[model samples]
Target chain A: MAMVEIRDARKVFDGGFEALRGASLDIEEGEILALLGPNGAGKTTLISAICGITQPTSGTIAVGGHDVVKDYRAARNLVGLVPQEVNLEPFEKVWKTVRFSRGLFGRKPDDALLERILRKLSLWEKRGATIKSLSGGMKRRVLIAKALAHDPRVLFLDEPTAGVDVELRRDMWDTVAELKREGVTIILTTHYIEEAEALADRVAVINRGQILLVEDKDALMARMGRKTLRIELDEPVAEIPAGLSDYGLRLEDDGRVLVYDYDTSAERTGIARLMGALAAEGIVVRDVATSQNSLEDIFVGLVHDGQEEEGVA
Target chain B: MNWAAVAAIYRFEMSRFFRTLLQSFISPVISTSLYFVVFGGAIGSRIDQVEGVSYGAFIVPGLVMLTVIMQAISNASFGIYFPKFIGTIYELLSAPINFLEIVMGYVGAAATKALFIGVVILVTSSFFVDLTIQHPLAMVAFLLLTCVSFALLGFIIGIWAGNFEQLQLVPLLVVTPLVFLGGSFYSIEMLPEVWQTITLFNPVLYLISGFRWAFFGLSDVPVGWSLAAIALFTSLCLTAIWWIFRTGWRIRS
Candidate 1:
């Protein structure tokens, strides 16, 4: 069975705001599943529901085969959440906060394990420092360390690098990679496609409270992805000529370039036909190139598709 | 129940309480001393006695009860409210513990703190007046009940309050006035018959009267009624908290 299973999870908040609309997914164990979405896309809501912070308006979520609501203790015991908010006892030292979190989960004190996790996060040096005295990046690391204190089966990082600098973001990515290598199941949500591309084995695109798609990152990019063919003419023109008007290609670089978007999977790409038509129109080509869409383009397209669905519904 | 979880929360709150150790210890002692100077010395000189005890001694139970109840509520309310304010409450909510365990941690710590402050005030009061506990066992019972009950009420208020202002609203606007009017400093017998009957309705009056009875063996109402009143309030607070946790109201949503 999947480590975490959310089926038909729907959260209609007060006054009919559908924060989550029948979202469902199965998270495989021991893999980093990045939930990719934009703001107001229900990423935080999903984590909240799964972590037992909030109940689903309707649906069932199970962690390690334990239902979050019916078997809350068992389910919550299997997961730890690093929330987007940096909400710690400002007066408490970092080490004590982490130790307190472990105790809260009914875990016996293991100073050795705690030390290892803190050191891994680069927070060991600041263990005696009060949380409020640390920089924002260090505080974020403290939050992560606290979540890991219980040695949970799954760790949910909700927008972990939202406000982090580039250097800290890179550090966080390295930490996540090392944890994944240690056989820990990590689930992170972010709008940064770069983070997802760098870390996630599988990516789930969520928008408007629904999972747009959940697929292996490579398969997702290869399937929904579109390829573009561009021709740079030998001479510049203002617009496409009448002879090539039927092809309806995009004109850019002062009409010096012609771009055609097509599916790579299709047998007839129309690239050869387009090139023949351009030649017949006496348009000389200086250079030819094809570019596959990056994950960012795919993410934007998915969000746009979800918006169109939002408009329709 | 998870004893470790309860202990964790309890210790965390206690550590926070001690972080302001200087102020926590000094403020109550200073305030009790001032009350003694004003109510016990300046005011007592004119009024010889109430119920055959010296004015200074008569107000001892009243003053202790006042401090214990207020301390219980404020400490418990702030204990829970700060976590909510800072968003650390999510960590608690997502943990493997239940609501009862959470309460045991917060309310337990609050009661302990209030009890500690009550003892300090009692010692402080002893320096100012020749006070005696006629029934030491009964006094401890009364003190414990008052501490736990008020701490529960504070927990409810902490969860119900949206901001810091609301956290203090009840203790300041409702509690202080009730304690002052509930025969804390004076005998209710001094009031007219109709007013005396009216004063019986104040819940704090029962706590003060029962507590005073423990001290000098004098009370405005029967000790039984006072004990019953505490039990009733305790049950009410429990029910409110149970409902809050069940519905996941305010905290969950």
Candidate 2:
């Protein structure tokens, strides 16, 4: 069963800009769901709606059986949000900032538990230092520490590694993995396809205020992914040959490479027949290589398709 | 009523307050003392007394009221503005606490800071000239009420403001002028009859008059009327804040 449910949630900002247009999805308990989208694709808006920062223009959201609008206190208590920005109180000490966050949720003070989280994030040594004195990466870690201070059942990280260095991004991924191993339900939004491919159990694609699709990570790759066979010709052709048109072969690399896009799931790939046809057409193939479409390519394709649809409208 | 949340926010604000401890305490003390040297010394040597009290003693309540109002508004405005500027307000909004608790945390801390500054100014005033209290409880009440009301007004300004210019606009343009012209340094009676009536229309007059009456047992307006004016102002500020939160104006969208 889904742990959090959003029913056609729509978030329209002021000036009639619709950030989320009937966007909906359910997050499973203890699973990491990565929401992938381009800029202005409503990724952060959807998270903000779930976290109760940005209220939905219409529809409803429930977390742990509590409605976000009617029963916000209960719903908010069940979720922790590490927002897109590292916005810690500059003058506040690290431990105190976390303690205050825990207390803001009406929790009793637990220094020992907080200390453990600090150590896990590697922020233990800087616990006494003011937030302004910490480095950018450490400050991001502090944001995560504060988010987990109250031990929220569900956590939302909006672009957790938007501007972080590669090393810090890797560390953040490890920390997220550790949290998932410990039974925390994590939902994060990112435009980085590689991160989503690496971290998420389920991936949802959103574009232009709509969720295009949501599916298991590996399942989605295998289902939508296709391989392209590129044949490097020893000679260049100015135009497509009439004989090879039936095989869906296109000349690329300025007519020096013959490209054939074929699905891996086909009962018979027909590569041999296509080669024979190409040879019959007197197109000498010097070399051949097959490359699978990556998640990155799929993301660009989906976003491009969405824009084209909008342009037509 | 999430008391823990209120306390948490309040403590964090106070921590920020103390982070600039030397500046907060010393600036008020030093500035108020300058009022003694310039206004009290230079002006008092010419016209020594007003309303049967020495010139130095006469402006004590006015100076304290001026500082308290300004400090409360500035501290409160900056308190809420910084969080919004840095985007940490989303954390507070997403927390399990309601809007009222958030207001209490911020306004309460701002009021407390103003109150502390008021006490410090009062102590500094005592060193320059003698002061007597006719109604100690009323004086304390006026001091606290002004702190809270002005802080609430400042909270409103902080929410309504979109930039630094708007943040300092009202405190600099409207509030300080009202306090200074409303009879902070000189008594309303010192002006001509027409000007005295015009000055009575200034809302700040009632606050300073009531506060002065607490110290000297004399006022330009009846003490009851002054109390009524402030009570009305406090409720008006409260009503404005309550409406702002209900509508989620500026703070929510």
Candidate 3:
């Protein structure tokens, strides 16, 4: 059975802004699920609802068979969340912050376990330092440490690497991977599709409070995602010839480059056919390169299309 | 529901206050002492005993209550406000800790600070005035009850407030004015009959009058009535705060 199941969940703020519109998804036990979306895409809102931070306008959510609202204690006990912002008591020491977080979950203190968590997060040395004295990256780690303090089976990270340095981001990825190894189901939201591509087993894309798509990472990339083929001509021309119009060719930089976007999910990508057609049109390609569409490109394309459609209406 | 969690959060918050050491512990005491010197000593020279007690001694319990109330509000409000401001509240909210645990932990810490300041001010008052505790246990009980009550009230204010300025509004505008007008500095008997009748409606009057009763066995209101008012206020405040937390009002959603 899935460890976390959210069904037909909806969230409408007090101002009548619908943050989540009947969203639903299930996260398998011990799997990493990455939520991808633009700002105001309801990623955080959905996560908050699941975490019981905000009650859903309508729907049922359960964590390990415990209804989030009816059995909140059990549901909350099963999951941990690290929010986007770094919020800790500035005067609190790193160690005490983590320890107190554990106790908040109604857990008994185990010095040995706390030490292990601190050492694992590489915060053992700075455990005694006040939160204000730490750097931003250190503060972020403190949040993570606190989330793990309770030893929950499920973890949610909201924009975990939004403003973090590359090094820390990499370290956090590794730490997340480590947590997954310990059989902890992880859910995360990120604008960086590469992070999702790198970490998630399943990906859910949300836009304008709607779930655009949710699919296996590889399958989504292969299916709804597109690929691009570009040809750098040996010389610049004024315009594209009419003969190549059927190929949906786009002229760039005074026609020095020709670009074709094709569906990767098609039985045949038509890359070879497009190249042949370009040659027949007397467009000598000096260099040809094929680029698979990244999750970012798909996300931007989907959201932009949605916006344009909204504009038209 | 979790005693362990409550204790841990309590200890952590209390330690944070003490960690500042001089800034946290000494600043309030010094400020309260100055209030005593200026208002109790300097101002008392021309004013006779307002309620059958020396002017200096008459303000002692009120001043102590004032100090306790201020510290309780300041410490408790800031305790919750800082976490929200810095964004650490997400961790607490997401933690397995229930809302009750969160409130108890924070209010407990706030009460601890109020109690500590109440004691320090009580000791400091001895240096300036020769007062007696007519009922030591009643005084202690009243002191703790008042501190915890205000601490709980402060926690609600902290959670409801979104900014530092908002946090200061309740203490500076509401509580301070209430304390000043609550008959802390003067007896109700000195006011006109109309105003004297109105003074009975001030909640802080009950607290101050009750504490005065505990000290000198004299008060404007009946001691039992004051005690009942305080106890009811504490319970009511506690219930409201608890409900706010449970609903995640302004704190989470």
Candidate 4:
């Protein structure tokens, strides 16, 4: 069974705003799944429902095969959440803050485990410091330590590195990677597409309160990711030659270069054919370069398509 | 039961109480002493006695009740409110523990704090007046019940309040006035027949009357009525909390 299973989860706030509309997903055990979405795309709401922080208006969510609503304690016990907000008691010491989370999960006092978590997050040296006294990055680390204190099977990081410095973000990525090595199932929501591309095995895209798509990160990129070939001409031409019309190439740099887009997975990219056609037309080529589309392009395209569909509807 | 969770929350809140030792402990003690100087000294010089009990001795239960009620409400309300305000309440809500356990942690801690202050006030009052307890066990019971019930009420208030102003609204406008009119410093019998009847309508009056009975065996109302009044109040607060959690009210939303 999937470590976390969300079946058609829907959440409507008090103001009648539907935050999650029939969102369904299955997160496998011991894999990093990145939930990618724009703001107000219901990422946090979905995490909240799974964590039992907020009840869904309809449908169900289960963690570790236990229903989040029906068997909340068992489900919640297996999951730990590091919320987007850095909310900690200002007067509370880092050690106590982390220890409190472990205790809140019905876990027995394990000072050794807490110490390990704090040390892993580089919080041991600052354990005696109050939350208010720490820097922003250190406070975020404290949140991670608290989440890991209970030794949960699955962890949810909601925008864990949203506003951190580059160094801290890299540090958090390493921490997440280490957690995954320990057989922990990780679900992270992020606005940074590169973060997902770098860390996720599977990528789930959400938009306007619905899951747009869920696929293996590499598969999604391969299936939808496109590559562009840019050819620099020996001399400038006013426009594209008619012979290259079948390739659908566009002239750029004042007609001195031609750009062709093709699927990397295609059996024949038509690049050789286009080049032969260009030579047959006496179009001298100077240099050629190929670039693959990044995850950001695919993400933007998906969200844009979703928005356009909504607009049309 | 998630007893560990309860203890963690309890210890967390208690730590905050201890962190503000001057405000939590010494302030109440000083305030209790000030009340003695004002009511027992100034007022006693004129009235001398009320129902054959020295005026100084007569207000001890009232003073303890006043401090206990206020402390219970403020401590419990702030204990819960601060988490909600700081957004740390998400941790509590998402924990494996149920609402009952959450309430047990916060309300339990609040009551404990109030109980401590109540005892301190009692001790402080003794230094100002010759004190006697006609029913020591009953006094303890009343004090405990008051602490618990008021703490529960404060929990509800903390959830209901959206801002600092609203947090203080009930305690300032409703509770303090009710306590003053509930015969905290003077007996309801001292009021006119019409006002005395009106004073019985104040729920706080029963708490004070029963508490006074434990201290001096003098009560404005029967001890049974006082006990019933508190039991009813506690039940109402519990019912409200049950509905709040069931409906995913302010705290959950």
Q: Which ten residues in a row have the lowest lDDT in candidate 1 chain A?
A: A304-313
**DockQ of model 1 vs. true complex:** 0.86
**What tens digits encode model 4's per-residue C-alpha lDDT throughout A46-144?**
999999889999998889889998998899999989999999989889888888888888888899888888888888999899899999999988888
Superposition error at B185 for model 2 (Å): 2.5
- Per-residue lDDT of model 3, residues A57-94, tens digit only: 89999999999988888999998888887777777788
Higher-ranked by TM-score: 2 or 4: 4
Off by over 4 Å in 3: A225-265, A268-288, A304-313, B28-53
Q: What is the lDDT of candidate 1?
A: 0.92
Cα RMSD for candidates in order? 2.2, 2.7, 3.2, 1.2
Candidate DockQ scores, in order: 0.86, 0.75, 0.64, 0.91
Question: What are the per-residue Cα lDDT tens digits for candidate 1 across A68-117?
Answer: 99999999888989999888888899999999999999999999999999
Q: Candidate 3 versus the native: TM-score?
A: 0.89
Candidate 4: residue B15 Cα off by (Å): 0.5
lDDT of 2 by residue, B4-121 (tens): 9999999989988898999999999999999999999998888899988999999999999999999999989999988888888988889998878988999999999999999999
Best by TM-score: 4
Better of 2 and 3 by lDDT: 2
Residue A302, candidate 1: Cα error in Å is 2.6
Q: Which candidate tops DockQ?
A: 4
In model 3, the Cα lDDT at residue A125 comes to 97
Instruction: For every candidate, give the share of true A-B contacts it also has.
Output: 0.95, 0.92, 0.85, 0.97
lDDT of 4 by residue, B79-114 (tens): 889999999999998999888898899999999999
TM per candidate: 0.95, 0.93, 0.89, 0.98
Superposed by TM-score, candidate 3 places the C-alpha of residue B33 at a distance from the truth, in angstroms, of 4.4
